[model samples]
Target: MAKQLIFKTKYTEHLKEAVSSGKSLEFYKSKEFVYDKKQVLIMPNIEAFPNLTSSLDIKDDFKTAVQIYEAFKGLEPIQASDERFWTYLAHVDLFLYMIERWPEVYVGKSSNPSKYLLDHWFISSSAQSSLLRHAISGLWWSVYLSVDEAKGENKYGLTKILFRQLDFPTRTLGTYKLGRHKEAVLGILEFIQENEDLFKTKFEDKTRFVTKHLNVVGGVKPIAYYDRQFFKSELEKVSGNISAI
Candidate 1:
């Protein structure tokens, strides 16, 4: 285990500039880029954690999400949201993973390398949407949201449903305000799990319909005050409309 570290705010700002200017493009390919002592600070009182491996073969986000969550499961929500910590990992520990997973951006093939770099490598904010966009933190947050302690051995059942497709989280959950509430997310996922036949076909359309419908429902009722069971029941009411979609 190594000490937990985060880039200093000044260095994070510098890194953002470097990403925009394309000055540090080659640096990302290197085995290691040495940070100046002043550029980083270790977190206090946090237990040392294992360094994430940059394995090119693991393309499955669900598996990677589980791995990432297990590794840094100790992080509090506030720390998990910190841009400095995630930015540091994106550039350092998971740099190769980023390059491997999104090679087009690194190879100058991406039309918008600057935007791609800024989006994937940096955590733009503590917002749910921003967190989902980040390459590393996205994985952690995905698992964090869907893993259920009450499910025992089948804890990742909902996680599997969430990551069943990339668009579910990116387009459906990330785009909607209802996703910010854990109970709502769990309810939506549980509903899908309970009726896989309806989702197996027209999954995107159905999920999009469900999320939009739930958002509309939230307009009248205080959905945030409800639990997963409430979300599940609400979703069941719209299952017919969802299926038609």
Candidate 2:
């Protein structure tokens, strides 16, 4: 029989009671939104063995924990033939995939470069560091992939969606605020990537015009109104004048 591992936080019994009584969200949000730099971290554990060739160096535990937790929350606990098989691959694969696929998902190293680092995951200096990092990376990658200067969406409406998505970080489109929007963004990115050269040339040539439109749309605060006709027209104008410089 495979051993079942249950997870728990080090929060005290009183904190747990308060959390269970619906006070956790406030604490969570407060801690997340207003935190100091000199705070201790709390995360999952990593079991890394030394590779004799490279000597003994510790790996990141926080990242491994978050990835595993995120994946688990996404995948859930499964009663498989082998328990170890269920977790080991899922944990490693989750982190590797996030790091490799998303340009914005950065894994930080220890401050002391000379130290043999073991912890992969790090608590942000502030309470909101985790949320901020995740949000920034997601927005950057999404914007990088979706904004097509060549085939600009109908009035930069697409751009507005991305930025608003960043600002709100809500869960309307099946993505929680500051969480991954893997499939939707992936689809858009794939389309943009396939036409990289074409789009790049267009964006570069009409930098001022394209940037103007982007700023206007982004600067529109809440982005309450988006005119499709304007987006289509601007995109067309920019697209037509691009050259492979």
The model with the greatest lDDT is 1
Model 2 misplaced regions, further than 4 Å = 1-120, 123-197, 200-213, 220-224, 227-233, 240-245
lDDT (C-alpha, whole model) for all candidates: 0.80, 0.31
Separate clash counts for every candidate: 0, 10
Candidate 1's clash total is: 0
For residues 1-245, write the lDDT of model 2, one tens digit per residue.
22223212232233334434544323222212222223222222323321211221124222332333323332221221122322222122223333332212132332332111101111122222232234222222333333445553342334443333233221222132212323333333333344456555434333334334434544553322434344444345555443323
Clashing pairs in 1: none
Residue 67, model 1: lDDT of 76
The reply for model 1, stretches above 4 Å from the true place, is 31-34, 48-51, 54-57
Tell me the TM-score of model 1: 0.92
- Cα lDDT tens digits for candidate 1, 44-124: 745544446643235688877887788788899989989998988877777667787867765668887778888888877
Angstrom error at residue 26, model 2: 34
Q: How close is candidate 2 to the true structure, as a TM-score?
A: 0.27
